[model samples]
Target: MSRRQRLMTLTRMLPSLLRILRRFRPYLRPQAPLLAGALLALLLSTAARLLEPWPLKLVIDRVVVATPSGGVSGIALIDALDPTTLLTLAAIALVGVIAVRGIASYFSTVGFALAGHRVLTEVRNDLYRHLQGLSLSFHDRAKTGELTLRIIGDIGMLKEVTVTAILPLLASSLVLVGMIAVMLWLNWQLALAALLPLPLLWLTTLHFGRRIQAVSREQRRREGAMAAKAAESMAAIRDIQALSLEKGFAESFCCEGNRDLREGVKAKRLAANLERTVDVLIGVASALVLWLGARLVLTGALTPGDLIVFLAYLKTAFRPVRELAKYTARLAKASAAGERVVDLLDEESDVQDRPDARPAPAFAGAVRFEQVTFAHTPGKPVLDRIDLALKPGERVAIVGPSGAGKSTLLSLLLRLHDPTEGRVLLDGVDIRTYRLASLRAQMSVVLSDSLLFAASIRDNIGYGAAGSDTGAEPGADEAAIIRAARLANAHDFIEALPNGYDTLVGERGVTLSSGQRQRIAIARAALRPSPILILDEPTTGLDRHNAQAVIQALEKLAQGRTVLMVTHDLDLAARADRILYLEAGRIREEGCHAELLAREGAYTALVRGRSGPPSPALSPAITRPIGADYAFGP
Candidate 1:
């Protein structure tokens, strides 16, 4: 960060500052009175401090020295007053000046702190709200720890500028202007000498501030990365332990940790050097003022009283400059933080609904994907020219060897990611034409592993009802939650727990078994009463009995609702009103289980390969776990 780089950084941040002001404008107008009062307090404090040295000058030249009577010199007009009386008056005035300044300073600090707090609260709320609406793709590519740092650490740093940087700079600038005006009035020659070092101080700020800013920026970036690394490692700790890769993860974390430490140290070092340079400059200015003022006084060109007053104001004035100079690094860090926040807020979401989009109509459970093609990355297609339709109450199972886009097709119905080309519709209306929330509300999804909050099991189960306790309704009524749980075969196990449904589950429901979590998730989806339901590998990873229990629960959930299940289990596929066999992103075969098997094509071969022989037809009891044998096929 040289001077040029610092300038560039400031230029870049100018827009962001305007952005901040725009955000605060709504809050600021309402609190203008408080802000005005705060500024007034600062002004009054500076006025009192300026009044302070005048009393000392009067005491020295008029009270103690008792200038040649009459209307003597510039200040001695009290001819009849005793020296003791005059001195006492001057002393009292000094104390009163100090008291007023202290009181005003207190008010200034409190007002700014409260105002900053209120404004920052609004900012955080808006940022968080925007974050919640961003598309899934945005979150998929973003690191949790980095986003957390932006929300917490970055915003916190910007707050420092509000409370510490801006106010202090304003007060310091005010003090500088008033003090120098008085100094020039006292004696122009001495004031000139005192102010000469200002240019040098500015130069010093640029010289040192750049290095500090550069190092600080690096430090902030490194810390964010380190936080992200730590969070990622902790999140995957179970996998690391199971795979015996803890040592590898620990080493990687340490490497980033060390980089962050070095950058932090470098930034601190630069800040220290900047502080010392400013301190030295302040000393030089003070010494220069004293040397010239003393010379003027002894030559009868100025009074001793005048010289003392000038020196006092000069010294006090330089203190603000010193404080300002010391804060360059701090201001830079704050600016960096603001920049990061602005960048995140500026991110555009591709999945947001159109401006004309309205609430989705009640779904009839009719779905259509017309010429849908998608690619997570361009040139490597996942689905090509996909076309499918299902009527109300239709139960469709999508089966394919791995990499056949079964899950992708299900995701399209929910619009987690829209197709790169083509359209998906619900009941003849393009789904994207409807508000995202309403569209999602019409479909209930039960993933193989759906997350539960770290709240009571009752709250977790209740959340499944879109817009109910979790989505729209009132308190998570215990009766309603239990009903859904019973429907999903989760009530029995939930009651077996010490606290039943009231038990607080750990993060992601880690305290419960895979089967228990799945059933709770199923109960949540079942509670949604949505016209459409999707179950992805609903019994994946479950033991035989749990799988049997889950299958039964699914059978009930599938009734009435138009259900789409993605699975490899021949037994599950047999239960669908119709099953589609997908391969290479296209529908290769579709019909009842018997029809597909009798044709003895792609669908028949897949069943035979996994089940070890071709059967007369698909059985309704062959539940088996398939691994990468499922991600993609040869």
Candidate 2:
């Protein structure tokens, strides 16, 4: 099996709590000192609890009953005092014990909470980084909402469980152990009677705990599915509204939401049942211990003060059991969330740099694909064995039918995915030998559908320079940005806007028209100082005026760069120095436009198919003059 497969199998094999602790141990290590302090405080609080009942016992034995002969050893001063002063001292001691326990408990809780927050914050950061590093294939198969839930919702839940449930359970267990030891030492018979309901408590806990966890896990799963649905619907709200699909999507989302609600109710019901069952068991144990202790006190075998202290310890001992039942459901839910996070972390990316990979040097932009082949699925090659090369400063266009692997060629050259066989070389070095970041820094791309962030136009354009190896601070060179925007014919409209370059664009650039968005994207790409320029259907949807402006921008952007254009616009392809006609993953024809048309093959048919009723203004004969301020010029 592969490493990812083995990890997945192991994730399923291990218990949830154990898996989470073991897998996330690295995050826990840094918080060790804080966690240790929290644990120490908890122990001190447990010790305070053990001493809590003694002051009451002292009042009963020494002051109320007037037992004169017996006094606590090593405290003769207290025994030397009169009954009224002794009563006052006992009362003060009771408050002091309660106060000490309260103070320790507060510190312990705060410490645990601080540690949990720090550790979970690191976990969330690592989870997000891992998700970003994962290959496109993993993302193509994953849900955005579910991944978002793991980062925000799941990690937040883990924090809550760690502080509120896990720490308290650990402290309660210590109290249970300490109280039980004292009860046994005080009176063995009464202690044994106090332990009778424990076996039944154990069985009840086991039964109800499993059911609650199962219900909680299912509820969490449904919640994730619901979130995924909501996110998907929101992301495509425009398309859904245009197509009138809102009702159907809403109904589907509500169905998942309702199912999640039902599971949540079921989990709560199970937890409630468990708590009540535990209460009954605790009541029976308390009654048995009280009955036996009272008889012992009356028969002179046990003192009245001793019986009172014994009962107090007995009550405290069962507190852990009651708490265990109370927090069992929350722990189970967090465990389910932890499993989800671990499963995501286990997914190994199909694409990553080799250990010996080095940063890519600056490129002259000569590219070659030698016997290259690739497939998203085995035996279904998207690009077959094909040899191709481009000289430095050459402009090459690729045209083919849908699914002809034209775009796949661009993807391979960009190193988005490695070839299934053979190699792709840039300036005679295999692209795989270069670091991904540095290799990608040598190229700039403009796509058909431009996407923009919800930021100012200046910031969006600044991203291009950020990706380059310019070594300049991002957005620091506003003069260069304005120059690029001018080259793309985008400066006039941008300045006409209410806020000019600093105007905020809506998500995905929905606030702007298509031509304006495209011009801005061109400006962004033009800002990059890369030797290779990639244009994929850059003018596909533009109107005549915008298309003419974009073509003029492209003419400037193409100067002195190795330009690779993928388009169905025969008019654009005809302008390239050479054209490669691809069909079914293989290069069918390659030559200058006139030479390809002379061959009377796929290239001729493609051109004829698109050129039947073309406008004269968009004709192949029309050409644009290049500007002095070149996009890729040094």
Candidate 3:
């Protein structure tokens, strides 16, 4: 990115970061009194540190210096006082300063820690919410591990910068300014000599800062890639183990991890060199100040006391410069992290609600695809010029070979993706004209591979139903759920489990058989009772017995709902009100099961395992009856 662009991005993020911090206002506001007390202590400590050199000067110029008159009995001598008394007073002041500084440091550390955590919490929450609002295409392209790192690791890095670095740097800068002002007043020439190296120091810091930022950005990117690799490996562990690809995955993970480590080491090395350089510069500046002050004293242009004070301020002045060098790399690292977070937040969702869109009224589920065409990539259409229509309460089956756009057609209906051309309509209104949420709310979908979260069986069953009743409604009234489960042939096995309805399913329902999971998904979809239903190979994983049971449940579910089934099962397609035979990206042929069989086209060859056109006199069993509402003209 260009410097100006980076600056503008940072400027935009400042408001959001500030807003995140404000979430901790309640915690911070309550600690205001303590913070004020801490500030008072800090000021007192700074005053004490500044005053320490003045007293050393007083002792040197008065008590240690011989007076022209035989004895030193002036105000400076009085201020120096008896050795025992002076030691006692100095000790007391040192203790007081240390006590105040310690208290202030504690309060500041604790307060900022609370604020940082609260801000991180807000960041995570906002990121997660934004992720939810983002379109499916975004998720399809994003790595789970990388996104997780942004939500967890990146936010954690920001928390550290906020609590440990930002406030301390601010306080240190204040101390530096105070010391510089005092040093300049004492001896302008000596102060200038001490400050001479500052310009070089700043230049070096800027160079190192840029390098650190670049390295840190690379490190974070590699870290995210490593995380993505690890997550992908873990998610597909079964496949890896079955294929004996463990070593391959491990090598891949190691490669990413090593890249991150190399970048991190490079960043650390640069930071270390920057700090060492600052230290050497400060040492040289200190030596120069001392040498200059001694010359002024020898020339009677400066007092021994003044020289001591100048030396002390010189040390104090370099302290912040050294700190600035120390934290320059840290700031750079944080800037890179901030840039990434801002990038995610700035990303625009590809599918967004139209400003004039309205919620779809209750749908009777009449669906239409008017020459819909779509593709994940340009000029590579997955569904092309597909025109079809389903009247209210009609059941249609889409049958085709794999990669023939059967599933793609179903995705269009659900608006998982919008058609690149034409439109999908519901109840005669363009689907795009209706709010996405309202349009989706009218339909229920069950996929071949159903994912169940790690939750109670009851929760999973009631996943689609609103206002769940585990108590008010008798266990029997859960009969509806049980009945749905029974129809899916899942109730018998479920009842045999220890907790039955209350059993907690493991993550992704791994504890359940594939057939069981599919049945549960069907039960969930059935519970929705929407006017529209989508079953994408819903019985693919089931055994003959289980598949039969599921088909029976589905038959009831499809009764009054507009049903769209994407499947390769010819028998199931034969029972549909109408069958759409898809080839490549278009509907090559469509008709009632008997009529399509008579035509002896792709459907006939697919069903009879023939290489040519089908015979008209195919057996009645071979040409099953299409449902009552079936219609197919093209």
Candidate 4:
């Protein structure tokens, strides 16, 4: 069992280590000089340590037991020196060697640590940038906590291997070779006895290496699961409390937390068990060498001092061997972490701009969808064979049942996902030909569940204003933000707050009411210099007063820009120049509101539901042709 496993140590650590090498290759190449310098320092430190043990051997033989006639000569000068004087010189030399070793080790570790930090930071930054650039579809399926673990926990473990384990492993390997060579020259029989337990030690390390790695990987995964559960519970704490679901959520969280704890305990037990076993094997090897060396000393094949040096060298030689086992264990786990980080970095994003895509010229707001079809999954169409054209500045309202693909229109318009078939064009050119940033710059959107960052109201508004300016950073256009807020009727409330626009809106705008958050979002959209506007249930959160005010403002804002609104309110839909009734993923009917109502189709049914008796309003007298400034009374 031991022999077969003896050579498996490298096999266990190799896979994860290889991944680390490949992922960090670009970052490491530029730091080769620093790495090389660290290696040199490690070598110097090892030399000093090896010399340290020899000084004692010299004192024991040439000075402490030097019978005036001299047992044997160490150096020409030391042979002539008196015992007391030689002992003093040897002690001083030992101190100097120790000092040199300390300095070298310090410099080597510091260099490696700095380099490791640099690489870790770069990896973190690159991972974050890539994650941000990934398509929404990817984020929809990937867990937030898993990605966070890769960024925070996994990379942190990798740094320990890179900075702490690497240099010691290199230096210890060299020292191991040099010490064994010296020990053999001193007494080949003692050297052989010293290495007798090496195979067993190697087998022990190999046996436990995989167990530790497997346990640690399981531990990290459980931790991620726990983190995700906690985040989810915290995010919905309000609902949980309101619905009296705290107990159930707490129980669920505890279940996951216990799972993570068990994983951690398993890993600790494996590591502790390996450590104890290695220590016992090491003791056995030392005992064997001691017994043999004593017999050889008594046989006059080796002197007492020679025996002492042999023992010292034996301990020194095996020191690295013992430490090597520990390092291999750590490296195994670090490799698992590296694998996770590499997996995330290597993940391909589904959305990417083509090399030949050019910056879109300013849009004229003329939008068209020609035979467009899209599906999140094959054969499960979200939009199918849609054909429509909206003249520049047309006000179009889209009404549909819950899954009739109303929201999907906004996604396609923003190029969040390309069509499964056909084309969407702006001004007769395919939108895919435009650079993403340029194309998005020409559109503004307001969704009911729009996200807000933990920032001041002014910064949130400026974030949108900045989008209108191609070269400016977000939150750089304060004046434009204020202007947009006034237009959205948000400026009065903003000023009424204690800190005005500078007040920090807590996480996800939780500090404000839903109505206030909605207004702020509307202001954000109003700040964009876009030729097209897309709103989904835009007035859902507003009170009647705010809704009416915003609707009035939107009516004015709608002029000279194509507006597409998705709403359940048929009254709002009736105000559009045209109403598009969508069902199942295809347009069923589209015409001026009065015209569609008169046809008694899907639009008529929706209007009838909201208007309750139809009130003779579907008659031709009410079928006036839609014109600019057209609106249905609130």
lDDT of candidates 1 onward, in order: 0.79, 0.84, 0.75, 0.78
Best by TM-score: 2
TM-score for every candidate vs. truth? 0.91, 0.92, 0.83, 0.91
Instruction: Give the CA lDDT, 0 to 100, for residue 387 in model 3.
Output: 93
How far off is residue 388 in model 3, in Å?
A: 2.0
- Better by TM-score, candidate 2 or 1: 2
lDDT of 1 at 65: 59
**Which residue pairs in candidate 3 collide?**
600-614
Check candidate 1 and list the clashing pairs.
402-631, 402-632, 403-631, 403-632, 467-471, 467-472, 468-472, 468-473
Residue range 189-300, candidate 2, lDDT tens digits: 8888999899889777777777787888898888888878888988899999999998999889888888888898888898999999999989988898788888987787
Give me the runs in candidate 3 sitting further than 4 Å from their true place: 1-90, 298-309, 327-329, 466-487, 610-634
Question: Largest lDDT belongs to which candidate?
Answer: 2
What residue runs in model 4 are displaced by over 4 Å at the alpha carbon? Answer: 1-13, 67-75, 160-171, 303-306, 324-332, 610-634
lDDT of 3 by residue, 1-634 (tens): 4556555555654675565455435546655665676566556556656666655665566556533331243568555577566656656765676666667666656655665576567767887888877877788999999999888888788888877677677667667788888878877778889889988886777667667877877888888888898889888888999999999999988888888788878988998999999999888988988888889888877777787788777777677777767776677667667667767766677766789999778888899999899988999999999999999988899976779899888888887788899999888888888777777767888888888879877678777564222222222347677877776667888899999988899988999988788878877777665799998987775665666666766776677888899976666777788999998998988998889989989887877745433222222324564322222112
Cα lDDT of model 4 by residue, 317-436, tens digit: 776656756675577667777888888889886767888999899889999999999888999999999998998988888987879999888788888888889999999999999988
Clash pairs for candidate 2: none
> Model 1 misses residue 68 by how many Å?
5.5
Count: clashes, candidate 2: 0
Candidate 4 colliding pairs? none
